[model samples]
Target: MRMIEIEKEQENPKMNNLRNFYERALQEFGTSDEDLWLQYIQEELGPWGQPENCGKIHWRAMKFLEGQSAESFTSKHALFQSGRL
Candidate 1:
């Protein structure tokens, strides 16, 4: 008989919030393409193929700048405009 062990999965609250924010932003902007999200993360957020945190940062910023608070940057459209859609 062989014994099997299962590793426990850790839950990150911050990451979960960020993911929720990203999903909301995507739905708000009506962007359903994964490639477009990847491209935006690469170009607007940071360099390509760096690390998970880097990508997360992009998603966070997009969520902040494009989600609901985006109205805050209405005057500074140049900064949050691109992320809006």
Candidate 2:
């Protein structure tokens, strides 16, 4: 546990930069952008995947996506939660 803490305290520079990049990009262009939200969600579902992180992003997305996009994301979320994704 101590080693894990130490490693996290020394986050990889490249990954740190990538996280910063995502923050800036989202701030500038992710508003009402379903595709960008989807991309960020997918990124969160990558190797560093965390359920809470994905949930937060998905909730945020619900505030933006509409019509067909919202429907699609909703269906996808249902499938994912049902283990049919």
Candidate 3:
């Protein structure tokens, strides 16, 4: 069962495209807002209804996005406080 799941993920083009879209959204928005992230994802998925179709993928991607955005903000804040930025 696990092997089959792995194989399915490996061969999934939609998942790959979703990841690419996440990357593009991060680059374009550069903000930590979850709504913007969801908007971008919904736009990309486009009437496919992500919550029903790709819930796990969207959840994982959102977690990664939030973490990345938080880390970036913390780093920039630290740099600014230390007179680096």
Candidate 4:
């Protein structure tokens, strides 16, 4: 079994591209074990799983969309942020 961590996330364009590639690969080559998929993503991206990475991506996107800086964003209050939740 694996454990996932929730932390202040950051977005990577490369990661998004990789996810799209993976989606296409899955459609073309068929599916594989989820654990294997996670392992592959971890190796290619980082320690966090895809969902967590995506969350980080969303956070960064939101920050950009709102014209906010990292210093202006509150990690602890993210869920309560008007446009974030």
Off by over 4 Å in 3: 1-22, 27-31, 44-53, 65-85
Candidate 2 segments exceeding 4 Å error: 1-36
Expressed as tens digits, the lDDT of each residue in 5-62 for candidate 1 is 1101223224343344445545554233343344334433432233555446445445
Q: Candidate 4 on 23-51: residue-level lDDT in tens?
A: 45434432323332333334344543354
Q: Rank the candidates by lDDT, best first.
A: 2, 3, 1, 4
How much lDDT does each candidate structure score?
0.40, 0.62, 0.49, 0.38
Worst ten in a row by lDDT for model 3: 1-10
Candidate 1 C-alpha error for residue 44, in Å: 16
Residue 37 of candidate 1: its Cα lDDT? 44
Provide TM-scores for the models. 0.25, 0.53, 0.29, 0.29
The residue pairs found clashing in candidate 2 are none
Cα error, residue 30 of model 3, in Å, equals 7.0
Clashes of 2: 0
TM-score of 4: 0.29
- After best superposition, candidate 4 residue 41: deviation in angstroms? 4.1
**RMSD per prediction, one decimal?**
12.9, 8.1, 13.0, 13.8
Model 3 vs truth, CA RMSD = 13.0
Q: 1-85 in candidate 2: lDDT tens per residue?
A: 2332343456452434444556566676555456666656665665654545777888877876767777777777777668786
Lowest summed lDDT window (length 10), candidate 2: 1-10
Off-target runs (Cα >4 Å) in candidate 1 are 1-13, 32-36, 39-85
